[model samples]
Target: MSFNESVLGKEYLKYCNLKEIALNTKTLDLSNISWFFPTCLLPLGIFIKEHKEIHVIPPIDIEVAKYFNIIMKDKIDSVKRSYIPIVEILPNKKLIEKNLDSLISNKDYNMGSLNAFAYFIGELITNIYEHSKFSTAYIIAQRYNQKNFTEIGIIDNGISIPGSYEIKGFNFSDIKALEEAIQGLSTKYNDNEYSERGYGLRTSLNLLTEGFEAKCLIVSRGVGLIANKNNRFFYKMKEKDIFNGTLISTRFDNNIREVNVYAYIDT
Candidate 1:
């Protein structure tokens, strides 16, 4: 069980069961419910006071599905249903800006961490706009804790990153392409705009160490997957089609314990 898995699992067990009980109760306590809801429990919290039955949508783990079903089983026939806990569904361009706003607004993130997040988000959105030509992209942002830890995901239905690279004249497989991308190599962009070549991908990875402690999971075209943390790197995706385009998730320290957001700028 990884850190997030443990956190989410605990939340699933607590909240799913609570929603079953809270549905029938006339008045529900918001603070008490926060225990189970955690930061990840969003829009679902909207129905905490009124809904009697809660059904969590699928595309989640089987264990979570089983327990979620168990909680809703007896609560069936209830007149109350709520939307998914997701905050907002965003397109590619807006998602990056929105995440930057979030990173800036939250007081828990420092400028360095916030900047790192901003750059990472920039790279991701750029990848989407630059690669996924099939459809508009969709991104979801969720805050999971007060400790400066947040999860942001950008999803697209277009071909995966590796596929995009192949289309761009790269014959390499997923792992090969991903490695190149993370290490600062580029199929299209220069390695370093300032240093004479492509550097966005590599620069972002390097920033993980210099500025703060962070972890990133990148699934791109020919690049199957990779993650970097504490100066050590690991492979997370192996011959798996996470999706077309890429899904980049990162957790970083916000640099500051408090951020006004309005004052934080890229300049």
Candidate 2:
């Protein structure tokens, strides 16, 4: 609920601390601590959701305790939180795509741009699979049934943003990679129907910050970028920071009433 740079910075520090503790105990839990930013929950969720050897406790807010599986439905039912385990996508990709296509809130978005949200989500997932060279990847989400708010997070244990750029023969510092990504500079040679290679992340960032008037956070390697409704800036993390892979998290408020996805995504 209290999500901002100051609060997120503290949570990031907490994430780093927990990462160190994870090495020793192999036990991670953050259910009790109220979140500063919903994205802060992703790193822990992605790591423990896969490794069964790691002991964990379920949280009421987000079901970090449950083993993640591809959700054919969007609602966060009592059975499980909305999530798609990275491993679940490969063997059943066709079926998973069908489910994801229907998973977005059909009622929340305007009909004209309804598919845009799903397209963005699918594009990011596709990028991770085709590019990340990830041993582990995950998508975790939380919805406050009481409020008009929902948050989704995607993360991976693959090459960070700079590494992705390097893989494409583009050498950039971590910050530069992130900056270019926000500027819609993709490492892919192929282009999507709507835009060039980098449409997914850049467009999503615009949709969240510009369209929805909300905040979006992207952390890659040790660098973090915080994009808010009016302003965007980068936060350089300390060398000892934990979690090297890219982390992206954002929220959608159904109460916003008007969101122009096309305004941000060039068709």
Candidate 3:
């Protein structure tokens, strides 16, 4: 079957469906893809990298193919022995820290902002190991000079937010699960008890909006949340397709200077 999305709608059910089938099938065809959002590309790349049995047919759209190549270059190179790009496979904390240092050092970003970025990355990655049961994760970052913004993406294939909450005896739709998640709640804490254990996503989003005037998108299961300085919106997917994991993408301005790193950590 051919899969294509022109705008790559706010909901990610389509990609989720494709990922599920691709994981089970011997060879997954991808030659029909025409357009895709960065949100979809991140998880798709992770899926392709982890599953060795799946062979993908390159996208027909030239631009889409280029993006697939950029994000999946490291994985592709492993099999084809070609030049790889900047994508990093995050297997441990030391490598994550090292990659962030290299990325920050390459630019002239302010020290405070750099520190906050490091903190954010650490918190997000820690959450994966502490809460998410997935064994593999990927990190990709890009500094867009012309757009005056930098984007950092973390992708993991694991239990979704709703799945985690469900395990704790709480019932929430995917969208509601994300809403509660970013509010500093977690399945790790009992339903009746108040705890500060799962503040990673909330604190990170707060730092991005409050400290750096940035934006963020978090998707898991069939829902997604988008937050920026002006507004926050949530989308609940109607489609049956689902991505059984999480993707965190944040955008920060290149010239950001003042940031409240302590505030995020303390809160």
Alpha-carbon lDDT, every model: 0.44, 0.62, 0.68
Candidate 1 C-alpha lDDT tens digits along 25-81: 643333333122222232233233235444333325554443223223322111111
Q: After superposition, how far is residue 148 of candidate 3 from its true place, in Å?
A: 1.9
**Local error of candidate 2 at 113, Å?**
6.5
Of candidates 2 and 1, the better by TM-score: 2
* Candidate 3 residue-wise lDDT at 87: 43
Candidate 2: segments with Cα more than 4 A from true spot: 1-13, 29-38, 49-92, 105-113, 190-195
Model 2 per-residue lDDT tens digits across residues 31-149: 56544334555576555655567775444455332422222223322343332222223323465565454456545447644555566677778777766777655565555556667
Q: Worst 10-residue stretch by lDDT in candidate 3?
A: 76-85
Q: Identify the leading candidate in terms of lDDT.
A: 3
**For model 3, how big is the CA root-mean-square deviation?**
5.6
- Best candidate according to TM-score: 2
Local accuracy of candidate 3 as per-residue lDDT tens digits, 87-182: 464656565665555544543567777788778777887788767777566766656566677667777887878788888888888888888988
Determine which window of 10 residues in candidate 2 has minimal summed lDDT. 67-76
Candidate closer to the true structure by lDDT (higher is better), 1 or 3: 3
Order of candidates by lDDT, top first?
Answer: 3, 2, 1
